[model samples]
Target: MLVVAGAMAETSLVAFRGWPSEALEFYEGLTADNSKTYWTAHLTVYETQVREPMTELLAALEPEFGPGKIFRPYRDVRFSKDKSPYKTHLGAWLEAGGYIQLSADGLAAGSGMYQMASDQLDRYRRAVADDRAGRELTTVIEAIEQARIHVQGHGSLKTVPRGYPKDHPRLDLLRHKGLVTWQEWAPAAWLGTAAARNRIVDFLRTSRPLRRWLDENVGPSTVQR
Candidate 1:
C-alpha cells in the first residue's frame, strides 16, 4: 500500500502488514518438491506473499538500521553436496549489522559476523584473551542470554584454539570462530501481522551491546573471501 499526499511526493512508504500464511505454505511445498517446477508454478506466491512483505519490512527498518538487502532465493550449489536448487528460507542483511529470515520453521533474527577471516579471528582471540575485554564480552553475552536470546559461536572448536592452554580463564570465548546473537520464534498467528516487525525490532535493539563489542574490538575481516 502507498499514499500520495500531493504532486510533490513528500513520502513514499510501502505498508508492511507482515507475511501472510501463504508464505509459509509456499515454503512447505518447496521443501517437499525442491525443483524448478515447484518454484515456477508458485512464482506469484513467492513474489507477493513472501518477497513483497519482506521488502516492505526492510524499508521500514531502514530508518534506523540502514539499508537492508534481501538474499537471492536460489541456492549456490557450486561447492555444496546436497545440490538443492532453491533456498528453504528468505533472508536479508542490514547494513548497520543484523539479519532477519522467514521460512517454514518461522522467523529468526540475528546480528554478528557469521564467519571471520584469519586476521579477524586472530584479533577476536586476542580480545577474548585480554582480561578486561574478555570479561566485558562475558557480561554482554550473559545479559543477552538472560533476555532469552542465545549467543552462538559459529564453528566453535572442541578445544580452545591452538594456544591459551586448558586452564585459560576465557577458554570458551577463545574457542569461538565467530560470534552472533540469535533468537527464533516458531510459527504462530502473530506472524501474519505487524507484530512480526516489532519482534525483530526488539531483537536488533537487544543486540546493540554485542554489536558494539565486535565493532570496537574484532571489526571487519581484512582478508577477502
Candidate 2:
C-alpha cells in the first residue's frame, strides 16, 4: 500500500512488505512457458506482487544507499537461439555498486565489477601489484570470506598474465578480468518475510570495503563496450 501525506503533488511512499509466493510461482510458470501469452496473462501478478515489492525495497534502501534501478524483464534475443521472451530473474542495482536479484533459487546479492574494459583491467592489475593496495584488498576479502561471502574473478586466465611475476604473492588477484564478492540463498520461508530485506541490507553493508577498494583503485571504465 502507498501512503500519501502532503497534497502538493501525488508523492507517496510504499513500505516493503516482502514478496509473496505468487511472485515465485509466476517465475516458475514463466520458465516453463516463456511465451508472450504467459507473460500477458500474469502481467498483473508481476506488477503488484513482484515489481512493486522490488520498488518498495529499493525505495527503503535509497536514504543511505542512494537510488536503485530495476532491470527490464524482457530479454534480448537478437544473438541467441533460445529466444526466451523474458528473463528468469528480477535484478536491481543499488547506486553503491551493489546488486540484488530474485529468482526461483531465492535472493542473490553482489558487489564490485562483473567485467572490466581493457584500460580498467590494466589499472586493476596494477593496483593488485602494489604491495600496500594488494595486501589491503586481500585483508578485506579475507574478512568477507570469514563472514561466508565468496570473492571471485569473472574470467581468469589459465596462467598469470604476462609482465606480472608468475609466482607473485598476489598472483591470483592479478589474473582476474573482473573482481566481485557474491552470495546466494536458496529458496526458504524467510524469503517471504522482512528478514529478506535485512539480509540484503547486511550483505550490502558488509561488502562496502570491497566496493570502496574497487572504486578507489579500478574506478570506472573509460573505454566503451
Candidate 3:
C-alpha cells in the first residue's frame, strides 16, 4: 500500500469480480525485486489491480463475515536480519473471523486463533482436559478435516504441560499453544473469477465451528500482550 504523491484518488468500492491475472504477476515481480524501485514503478498495478479488488472483496463480504482490513504490504524490517522491503502477498483478516491471502503460489484462507496467550492457554488447557469440552473440540476438528481442510496446532509442547497427564487422550490438543484450519488453492482459472470469493466464504463457513468452540471454551487472553 505505498502511495506516491499525486497518485489518482482511491478507487471506490465495486462488487468483487475477483482478481485479474496481473495481480498475481505483480507479486511475482515483487518476489524477485523487493526494493523501492520495483514498488514505485509498479504502484499503479498494485493499487488498481491488486489492492482495489481486495477492497471490493472485503466490501462484498461485509454483511455475513463482518468487515475486513487488508494488511499493509510493506515489511517491518527494522528488527529482522533480512531487510526485504515488501510483502510478497496481499493478506486481510475479517473482523469476525478468518483470513485470506493472494500470492504467486495461490489463494489461501484460514480460521481460528493462530496463537494463544498465557491466560488463554491456561483456559485452553483446562477446557481441553474436560471430557465434555475436549470431546466437542475433537468432533469439530474432525468435521473440518473431513471436509478436506487441514487443522493443526502451533507452538506445541513436546510433552504434556505441567499437571497434565502425558497419557491424556487429547494430548495433541493439550500440547497446543494454538489451533487453526487452513486451505489453499494453487493458481487456477477460477482465481480470476468470482469463484475465488465463493471458495473463501465456503471455507470460512465450514471452519466456523472451531472458532465457536474456542470462543466458548478458551476465550481471549486476560494478560495484555
Scored by CA lDDT, what does every candidate get? 0.92, 0.90, 0.91
In model 3, pairs of residues that clash are: none
Off by over 4 Å in 2: 1-13
Clashes of each: 0, 0, 0
lDDT, residue 182, candidate 2: 96
Candidate 3 has what TM-score? 0.93
Q: What is the lDDT of candidate 3?
A: 0.91
Candidate 2 local lDDT, 51-161, one digit each (tens): 999998999889979999999999999999989989999999999788999987788999999999999999999999999999999999999999999999989998999
Best of the candidates, TM-score: 1
Top lDDT prediction, candidate number: 1
Model 3: residue 1 alpha-carbon error in angstroms: 38
TM-scores, each model vs. reference: 0.94, 0.93, 0.93
Cα lDDT tens digits, model 1, 67-111, are: 999999999899999998999999999999999999999999999
Off by over 4 Å in 3: 1-13
